[model samples]
Target: MTARPAKAVSRRPPRPARRTSAVRPPRAGRGGPRRLYSRVRRAWDRPLTAYYLILGGSLLITVLGLVMVYSASQIKALQSGLAPSYFFRKQLLAAAIGGVLLLAASRMTAKLHRAMAYPLLAVSVFLMCLVQIPGIGVAVNGNRNWLSLGGPFQMQPSEFGKLALVLWGADLLARKQERKLLTQWKHLLVPLVPVAFLLLGLIMLGGDMGTAIILTAVLFGLLWLAGAPTRLFTGVLGGAVAIGALLILTSANRMSRLACIGATDPGPGDQCWQAVHGIYALASGGFFGSGLGASMEKWGELPEPHTDFIFAITGEELGLAGTLSVLALFAALGYAGIRVAGRTEDPFVRYAAGGVTTWVMAQAMINMGAVLGLLPIAGVPLPLFSYGGSALLPTMFAIGLLIAFARDEPAARAALALATRKPVFGRKPAGVRWKTMRRRVARRPSGER
Candidate 1:
């Protein structure tokens, strides 16, 4: 065997680069860098643009939410004999925790994200189940979706379930893409849709139709992005509408809510009282608003002014300017999230980004719509702009995931590499001249310049 020796392997030569300009991008002929606006725009159109947009928007919204929460809650707290800052302190603590989660998640690697998906799904399912336990689950208003773990702090399992669903669905779809399973409708819908239904069933079982609707939005978004057939989408949408109608019909509360949708007078009970007062709050503010913490609605004129109806309070206090600013921030978030989904090469990134964007945008729309009397009173919280601790933490974490995806973009990678390189004695460590001059000298053969 040793005497037989080995056969030498041959390798193919590398292909030459194409000479045509079509193989390259069009460059500016001249003066491109001289235009400051164009230069800044080009710089901002890099891989990390989405990252900065998400960060700035999320921070602004969260801070604004804290301020508004305090403003809205102070009166109620004083009446309850608690300190004015009691609710404010709780919300600030939640924000701080969420901030830490955001920073940690932003630094997570892609592999880690994929790895955590399944476990998250399992854990979220278990938590949702636990929320059904008689002693463990505490009923708030009408929804038995919160867990009271022996303290002032309570956990809303459905909120974490939303995050888990995003991760798991993204991971599942990404795997399907790897296996080329996305093209077949059966392969695409199986398991994912069924699992989603299961989760939604559990959430609705807890009487949390609002959260269920948001989760449904996430499911619809993921399916849309996965390229399900038009017919299939229509069928699914129809089924959703039917289910929504049935849910509304079954509950007197929900029925009253629907009736109040376009009502100038919600009549008798406070079934639509919040919505009516919300409109009043906004109307009384006029254009410039009454000023921060100046909301008359917060003085028991409106209900849940710090939570589901914070946007109403915002309109009342901050006026049109403040409301528009809040809308602008949410628009920034939606833009950044969608931008990330559109630009990423990974299926997980695309699915996850789209799912989170849909969740946040849909929830915001529902919350604002309910307050403004456009939709039924859904009781959904505005993302990053509502006063719920459970909602804030997972949402901030999702935003962090979007940031992580942005940072992983190619331009961001290149920028990071360039920034990390140390310059040699006040000169760039790498540049066009440094590379080209040495190359030209080498081509001259005897160190000739």
Candidate 2:
């Protein structure tokens, strides 16, 4: 048999049977779309994904806001005899300052966060009060919530108040939870409600029902997070509804907004003009949009093309696609906030994150609803996307706080360590660990056995 096989064999040795490989994993960061999707999904499972998601989402929206601000305000800026980049420049400055604040906030330790909680609340309250002083308080759009620092430098204390409430409320509830006091309704209601109510009173006095509504959301959100009784929310709900309705009825300006929502007048009234123009801006965009910077609405047809109704300009320029993109971005942000809030082991992180999420999301919904005629137009800017220095600064800072909480997670810690570790390729290993070295020494002596 061997001789027969040798007879058949050629000059070369019989080639080994072609070795078949076992199924190999697709190369990382390679392959078709499906493989790419799978890789991304897997990557998302890593520890720092949440932190990166928050950072990326915040940065994108902020940058988008700056671009839109420039586009939306250019015509108006020029019409006002100012530089075309006036609003853009101002917004850029605010964003720069806000980005710095964000980085600083994300790096703060938990102890520093806790330590600063009361001081933040105090500063917010003091600023809120300062806005009530004779000359310091400046009214805009009928809201006396602005602190006048001089020409072209007014700031909204109310925006900062939103963050202050979250921090202080989180601290308060966390301390109470430690003592098992959260179970008591009184402990739940005290301090937070009183102080929040006082703050709300001051805000309402400024005639800023929009800010008041957002603050109320923060207040209720913290309550719900701390496990307040259903009846408590019910009572609070009824009270809030009543107060909101009363406030709406009492103000001619707010009532007009209410009318704008329900107005059936074929012709737009002065009260309904802004709302009507917003609808026009959005509707005129069709689906894809009128084209960015090509919005007729932004060309003096729509009010607040860069500020409150930027969504309208977006809809007009990018069309429904643009508007929905804005909404989608906001939804993504809300999802991220929920993820951060839910994943935290710390009660303060949960409470504060939840409150901030509620404030931002609730405010967004109202602003969007108003633009859509589903609700009254509240003069709240669209969080990070709106062209307001006050709103932008605090929102970026809150995002930073969320980043800090995300960083505090166990997975994030591990990811950070891996990222910061020195590359292993060229470095000498610290000659075996001390314990291992000792074990080796002992093993050498035991070889006598």
lDDT of each: 0.88, 0.84
Model 2 C-alpha lDDT per residue in residues 1-449, reported as the tens digit of each score: 45544456467878899999889887765668878898888986777777887888789888888888998999989889999999999999999999999999999976687888889888888998998898889988767888877788889888988988988999999999989999888999998899999889989888888889999999999999999999987898899899889988888877777778855442544668888888887778899987779989887877888999988888888888877878877887788788889988889889988988898899889888877778888888888988999999999999988889889998889768645544269542343222332232112434541
Clash count, one per candidate: 0, 2
Off by over 4 Å in 2: 1-44, 262-268, 424-449
lDDT of 1 by residue, 277-348 (tens): 989998888787999989998898888989999998899888999899999999989999999999989999
**TM per prediction:** 0.86, 0.85
The local lDDT score (0 to 100) that residue 110 gets in candidate 1 is 78
